[model samples]
Target: MLILKKLSMAMYMDQEDINIKFEKMGKIRTALVGYGSVGEKMHAPLITVCPDLELVAVVERRQEKSKEKYPEVSIFRSLEALLEADAADLIVIVTPNEFHFSQAKMALEAGKHVVVDKPVTIHSREAKELKQIAEEKGLVLSVFQNRRWDGDIRTIQKILAEGLLGRVVHFESHFDRFRPGLADNWREQDVPGNGITYDLGTHLIDQAVMLFGRPDWVYAEIFKQRTGAVADDFFDITLMFGSIKARLTASVLSKAPMPKFLVLGEKGSYIKYGLDVQEKAFKAGELPEGANWGLEDAQAWGELHLEHTSMTYETERGDYRIFYKNIADAISQKHTLRVPIDQAITVLEIIEAAFLSHQEGKRIPFKK
Candidate 1:
């Protein structure tokens, strides 16, 4: 009798401990809606690394690409199937720009919190509608403006905050690439929201807005530089904020080395070369966690040219993991969203204005 009583008590205590562990875990089951390069390289790894988030399922329409990397994760052949199964509490839409709106809408209607990639939707009105739906459902709706966490951008932010670059006069950001031949992909195709403006322009514009809120006017020039290209491969956009002028440009044919960021202020100037190291590391299959992760080399630091002197400024650490962690926190009501939907709407508005400016050959004043 004594032995039996001891065994029963042990079992009860073990079960209690298990319950505590489960409660403490408190991980939100996350579902990734696409299996493309950004999804595979950046989103999946970041989601897996977050302790508060679990990558539970994936939406791969044709192939089971996610299974090999995430064996335990269930793979659904379609978003509809995943929704029917109610597999996830959080849905991350990393599909093409065209599908972002419909996919995000479906996820929200299914009562799931959503995280859409940059340019939340191709149109500002659609983004506002998503925001309204999420608000009505009391759910979190966020856009992935991940470049706001870039090392070079963070360094620029710090410089501006500290007044190191007193009274910033001009800001130039470039996402130039050397791809003379067009790749066979949806981005290069002639589709709505298929261009450098929607692809790279979103990031550049978002970063600029983060730094200097909204601009007074937007003037842009967009073109198709590469032969046989149906979509725009080049863009030079200028955002006028009173006296401060921000030039955001990207090109597919530029072979010359241009600074990734060049900011001119009354006191000094900052010029940074090379993209964030984290992106290259991510493409190389490196996870987000490590002692040396997200650190830019000393040689790659931006140079601050001041009156009678110039010195290299240490680049800030870039961590995209913060974006996912914030998402998890926002879902749990522990924190407010870092990348809000309204900001994304403003970005789309600016993108629209840029297109209008390009077509009309005139600068367009911001309405709001």
Candidate 2:
């Protein structure tokens, strides 16, 4: 372990080495809805950084909380008022899951591009309806599956792309936390889309589908593990894609350190610990600027194990800005949506299947 750790202590690469030239076709007036933790911390900062996106407005019902950080943005009491004022060309819904469908539907009908936080909607049917509306109205629609930009995930993608793992047969991912006490947040309440399944499950399942396409079947055991928690806090979902099996797990009561990702193949395997660093930076209220943005420490890189040897693998720089950048480009017709609404709907369906599987104690088959 000492030798590997010492060998892994290579210099971090220059940020410019991975940076891309952002092309802006046209500036999009973006409005952020729900100035909650995700909206203020993640969505707003990402929107303000993209060269082709302009942060023009925010929607907060009780207070103008967004104004403290983004004073230039117009504050409205509701999505309806924001629409009435015609304040933005793009609508980003970061409200709770229940509001995603209605708000996204309203924005699409208003002829505005829409971006919703993950899960897209509480139900897959609602997501499908939103997709149809976006198609019919000629609007850009995407979900905030921003974890696709996570450094660890980027590393995994590169490893698979290079065939370093050679015909991977098994994959496992964990998003664990140690929050024994429940909070007053909506996620902890007995509300629609109020569980780890809808939260982290959306990200894990989206990443799975993004890499392996829709699974052939799903088996899961999802339940609330906390003592006083009314919402679910633990989930172990298995997504089966023919020869490959992907296992995803998340829990709020977990304390023991677990591998963030573990993969096995015929030739080798990869084991990575620690989560991405971008969220920490964002929560610290750092802007997604400068050359060294999204780069992780060298000591935190994943490890690759072959038949005879093993070494640390450099992680790809994570950039959540890519999401909004693609959104802007799609709106400009310069590029396609990376997190398309269709894929998000599939994730919802998978989540639905997982819940059903948990209830029935059987693997749920996918619709062909």
Best by lDDT: 1
lDDT of 2 by residue, 1-368 (tens): 98777666533433332123223224678999898998988898899889888899999999988889888999999999999999999999999988899999999999999999988899999999999999998788899999999999888898899998899999999999999998999998988999899999999999999889999999999988889889989999999998999999998887899999999999899999999999999999999999889999999999999989999989899999898988887776667789888899899999999999999999999957
- Compose the digit string of candidate 1's lDDT tens values, residues 121-147: 999999999999999998999999899
| Root-mean-square deviation of Cα positions for candidate 2 versus the true structure, in angstroms | 12.6
The C-alpha stretches of model 2 lying farther than 4 A from their native spots are 1-26
**Least well predicted 10-residue stretch by lDDT in candidate 1:** 14-23
Q: What is the C-alpha RMSD of each candidate to the true structure, in Å?
A: 7.1, 12.6
lDDT of 2: 0.90
Clashes of 1: 0
Query: Which candidate has the highest TM-score of all?
Result: 1
TM-score of each: 0.93, 0.92
